[model samples]
Target: MPQKNPNPKHKSQNRAGLLRHLNTREVLAMLLKHGGLSRADLTRLTGISGPTITRTVQDLLDAKLVEEGEPSKALLGRPGKMIHLASSKAGVMALVIGQDACEISASGLDGKLQGNLDRFPMPRSYSEFLSLVSQKLKLAKPKNGVKLMGLGVSTPGLFNLLEHKISSCPSIPFLENQMLAKDLEANTGFETFLLQEMHALCLAESIFGESRNLSNFAVIDITHDFGLGVVSNGQQLQGHLGLAGNLGKLPIDKNGATLDAVATDDFFCKTIARLADSKIDIQGAINLFRGGAVDAMNEINLMIDHISTGVATVVNLFNPERIFIIGKLLDAHPDLFVNLLEATRRKSIKASFIGCTITRSKANSRLGAVSAVIGKLTTGKKFSLK
Candidate 1:
């Protein structure tokens, strides 16, 4: 016997609702990228009907998701009122769990930070971390007319995507095997999402940094560890398990040493300290290099060689249009970043190398954390009518 179809009206309604949602999303995305637009402009850009665009704009205004602005005097003839995304009317709380300190910040939907970044010492235990977060949440009330929509955490480690739990965190071992996002959401009564630091950086670049509006790019993070974040065809390249950008583990030598194993921040610091016969931090090492310390310069050069190799691999494999490098190593000398770019070009395939622009990343981890939350709220079916 054939199975009976159910609810034809419901199916039709669902289809119509989906189309409406897509139209709303298209309008919002256009406004986000281009700032304000008249209903007529949105209709022309989105290829939607003028009546539908006006209706959608009214709906968004009524929902407080968008606001109308003064008519543009630049346009010829009768100017239409401009509609802008209500980025300031809603915001998200972002927490970045780092090796040295945990940073918390808030940002509007526009990806602009609302206030100064707050930093606290890294908690030694999971319970302590939660207690600190809870304390902060109590004081994190939204301003008048602004809604705190969600929480976003940018952390360093491998994650079990299926479980929404951290699988391993070398810097903060207490976080391993913990359902951090679930716990935070349950406690705070807000939706929560976790992103690895590299992925967060990717989102940051795509949303607010140099890669904005560009679909193909890569972010190489060399701050604490070597990692890569690839955005291809306008999507972050997370592997099946949500752990795709571990570029540090790429083997670059015949002796089986990984990129990260030999070229870590700790290794660089220790190597410089040993060479100088004095205990020194990364900044001090940079000072030594500036003072023409041969040994310090040599160590920096060696690390740059490894980093360039890693970058070349990314260029060859991903063919990203731009590659942004993030780390303090780039600040060691005025010529260091330039040297890395030149070295990467020499090692990469000539055709691929010519197409990719390599530059130092300017976005910070705090921005990355904020971008993660913004991305969570704006993308896919997660964004909804009020």
Candidate 2:
């Protein structure tokens, strides 16, 4: 038998590592953004040569990063085979650390639900949270072919990815400087990421939501929490320490009432209850606003003023193209959004009433638990922590 050449240049890449590389990354990004397409489509989109495209795609298929679903034949040339990421392989899991509890779920790059949103009691410590994340993955008992890529935690905090520590997480005490990313990664032997909650929402929205076209826009979420997502030049404004777009903490109601202090779900509940002389949860306050309770409307109008103050600050600073408000206030006061738009016009000197559109997120909130995983996978090297 002839001695075959064992080339050092052709070292094999494990299934996951190969897809995580450049050529397939280009292909993955194209398929993710433009939808399923044939090799010809990918070559055109990436500006790569046909031969390189063929070889790279073959690598993806062999590594199972991508798979062929169908062929498109125009009859004028060779049939084009539709290629897409092999989502069938182990799905990504995300763990959302909500204010109250935690939620874990699995989803695909298409943002489709793969598993039920599994709830875990809010852990007291960052360590506890890390433990539950692994516990849930174990409980899910993911079947083979669906290799677990890794996990991401959605929490209200600042992640200093540089330091690999959560610089600050007031909402979830003890998370400060916890080095969650490193800890989780070391313990689980899988890549782990920590992301700000609303930023994650923004990433999810930017990929598939009202903010799709507005690359330089911001998504200001007002729900149980108050946060903003800044998307700039087609990427998130994850400033130093992962604390970019934290508009909620900005001073608004100088009466010591910050945006989150006065505009969050807790604020609504407390203010509504105090004003109405009755306890009203977030939904009830929303209902009360919808029912057109005169007092509720009055309070809501005042609240919108504070909201406009917060938004004005953001507008003057970032000049975002859109400011999305995800809360009952939008459902109640169309005038508030109109008023904020007007305020934004007045506050920023050069800021000419940037076309601001405020509305609820088009993507499911439930994706919060799994959305980060999708983001990490699709974000490629520029943002990939692993």
Candidate 3:
């Protein structure tokens, strides 16, 4: 269905270009980590040759992916021009797909949002969702000269890296086994990558939240399901098929009840509804607890115990230096975070819990989306001039 290039010299040139692009990505990644660096710094940090660094930096400057900053004062010799990401030269788009809604936002390279977040109800089917996203992206295209780099999606589910599709998503059955990232890229013409929601939150934590400088930390998402994301030695621990954090079905108790069976937003919501003998949302249940309703308080305490079990398991297993829990149920009350912290410390191994700090996460999925785009553009894959 397609034509192939037969020219041997053309193939060699293309290979050379790809190698150069990869070297440029390595330079960009180094810049992203350190914020600003001189040409010598890049060469030293990346182990790239001085000439390659010079050529790569010039190409980046021409592409507007990087800009020259003030000259640095050299202690031993002449100063060098500092290179940094051009925050205003281009922007990236973030799409977070939750059970109830889909959030779309655009941010500059500096990770600052350019405009207000736009949200839409979750479409009923895959085709409908694709169409909606495509249409919305068309309307959200930048009118200014700022080029849009790519789109990053934060989704709640297990993504099959081997198959390049969503392998499992209980909340949205329509997403299972769907090639979501590839389809989005095909439809929207934006470089797209999909990550589990918790992974995104983990990235957000590392970039913008409390885990910024920590080399070992864990991010737990206790929403409709229980999920875990871990960072060790400054790298995400993605096991086979990037499914290392699939903790929903983990057997926590001897009774054979799964983690999600006892500790989940849906479980808490349903338990409170049954206790109150009425259909109520999670926030309403929190309000009931705040009002000193005896039944609500009991249910809340039990929910905390379940959450502590999950958190304690994470501590004992991963031995993370810090743990961040993100959930509406966890943030419902001022005392919940403190109570959970104390309870987790009690349940986990004393040595493992010694220095681990359990805290509530303030970072949302939006930052994760932004980090995803930056990661793809700089490190995930080789880029193209086209």
Q: Which candidate is the best by lDDT?
A: 3
Two-way lDDT contest, 1 vs 3, winner: 3
lDDT of 1 by residue, 1-386 (tens): 99889789999999989988888888877876778898878988999999999888887777667778899765477898888877677777888899878888777766677877788899888988987886786477457778776777888988767666788888789999888877776777767767788888887887678888789999988877797889999877877877678888788789988888766666677777787888898788767767877456766788888888999999999999999988775776888888888888889999999998888888777777776656654555321101
| Runs off by more than 4 Å, candidate 3 | 1-61, 67-84, 251-257, 271-280, 293-295, 380-386
Report the candidate with higher TM-score, 2 versus 3. Answer: 2
Model 3 agreement with the true structure over 338-365: per-residue lDDT tens digits: 8888888899999999978887788788
Report residue 30 deviation for candidate 1 (angstroms).
1.2
Predicted structure 3: clash tally: 0
Q: Give the residue spans of candidate 1 off by over 4 A.
A: 1-12, 251-257, 264-288, 291-295, 381-386
* Clash tally for model 2: 3
Q: Rank the candidates by lDDT, best first.
A: 3, 1, 2
| Candidate 2 TM-score over all chains jointly | 0.82
Candidate 1: clashing pairs of residues: none
Against the reference, the lDDT scores of all candidates come to: 0.79, 0.68, 0.82
